[model samples]
Target: MDTGTHLVIGLGLAGLAYIDPVVAADPMVSTAVLIGTVAGSQAPDADTLLRLKGNAAYIKNHRGLSHSLPALVLWTALISGILWLVFPALPMWHITMWVFIAVAFHVFTDLFNAYGTQALRPISERWVSWNIIHIFDPVIFSSHVLAIFIWSVHLMRPEILFPILYAFLALYYIWRSWTHYRLESGLRPRDPTYEPGDRYTLIPTVHLHQWQIVKRKQDGSFQLGELRNRKINWIDRVSCAVHPAVEASKAHPNIACFLYFSSYACAELKEHAWGYEVRWADVRYRHRKQYPFVAVLLLDKKLNPIDSYVGWVSDSRLEKKLRMGGA
Candidate 1:
């Protein structure tokens, strides 16, 4: 979810807090909890501050440690404590409780997207991406927006309205999950052509009925598809050669960082205007013929690296970057 959606959700949860009669009666406590919820909701994303240094560091740790279990406890305590200092009249326990809920909800929702979090880090560093929801979903964001609007108009009290809104949202997620499974099952290669490395993954788009699919086979062949009407329509196929990491390319910092973050990565060795280009791509995000999270290394005929890039860029920008050769 985007930052705006998360912040709106925080505000909606604050409205839901009015369910507590004590919160409804005490303006000071109500203010404190609402502030805590809004702040806590975005606290885990604090790792985005790393972008100031460069994209490599930012991509490496954006959701790695900041969204982990230990960090969850830390964010709750830190945000609650900060808010409590500013408004000392509020109950300390109340601030902590609401902040905890906001932070926990942020972590929970992130798992539904393809760019998941290492929520169980330290216990297990594995990434947990359910791939059920798009990174940005119109339905999810609009639901929260509508809740806030209704609350603003006082058409109904937030406490009553939020429960109804969230209940419907919960059911919607269940239906989407089922639909995702049906779509994936439809794409499975049921014929005798299934190879050991044959695998498929669906990437959600803005539309509920459409998805981008990437299929890989043991022979290093690739197929891209679009899912509509619960069926995959083949868009194109391309084969990429795979090789053991070339010593020079492997030694590059950008390549190391790209490999660490990519789930289904493939590298292509191609000729470039300068000499040669090594394009490392994560197929999971292959949509609209662009690979955003990629590492491009331009090398000379001797295989000596001339320049490199490790971050998101459009096809034109990537080509421009390679031509510049680290300039």
Candidate 2:
């Protein structure tokens, strides 16, 4: 989920806290809980500040350790303690409980998106992405906005409205999961030639009827396509064999970091007038017939990295940047 969705859900959690009679009776406690919830919601993502160091550091660490099991406990305790100091009259237990809920909810929701969090870190570093929801879902965001508006207008009580809204959202998640399962099952390749390493990954788009699909083969090739109204529209196939240039480029920091972050990474090696260009891309996200998340490395004839970049850039801009000698 995006920051806006997380914040709105945090506010929704605060509203739901009013179900407790003690919180409902005290205005100061309610205000204190609101602050705790909102802050707790955004705490895990504090790792976003790593961008100050560079994209490599940011890519390697964002949502890696910060969204782990240990981080969740730390965020809850730190946020609750800070709020408790500001509102000495409120019960510390109440503050801790709500803050814990808000922090846990943030990690849980992130598991459904394509760029999932390392929520199971310490136990396992593997990324757990259900691939059932987009990073930003209009339905989830707008529902929270509408519910907040209704609460603001005093059309319904917070305690009553939020519980109902959350129940509907829960059902919505289940429905989305079922839809993904059905689509994946229908697309599963039954050919005996399909190697054990071959697999299909379905990534949801903003539109419910549309999804991005990646078929990764054992040979390090990828078939990118789109699923619309139960039909698969094949888009692009990236078939690149192992090459010395591609192997050498992986030693560069930018390319290494991009490989670590990308699940369906593919590399293309091209000989140029100056040297060689090794283009690595994550095939999971395809927009406007372009794979924007990429890492490009220019290597000399001797396979030394001259210059490199690792970030999101459109195909056209990437070409311009390469032509300008990594400007």
Q: Which of the numbered candidates is closest to the native, going by highest lDDT?
A: 2
lDDT of 1 at 308: 84
**What TM-score number comes out for model 2?**
0.94
lDDT per residue (tens digit) for residues 216-265 in model 2: 88777888878888878777888864889999988899888888877778
Tens-place lDDT digits, model 1, residues 31-88 = 8889889998999999999989887788778888999999989999898888878987
Alpha-carbon runs more than 4 Å astray in model 2: 189-198, 319-327
In candidate 1, which residue pairs get closer than 3 Å at backbone N, Cα or C atoms, i.e. clash?
Answer: none
Clashes of each: 0, 0
Q: Each model's TM-score?
A: 0.92, 0.94
How does candidate 1 score on lDDT?
A: 0.81
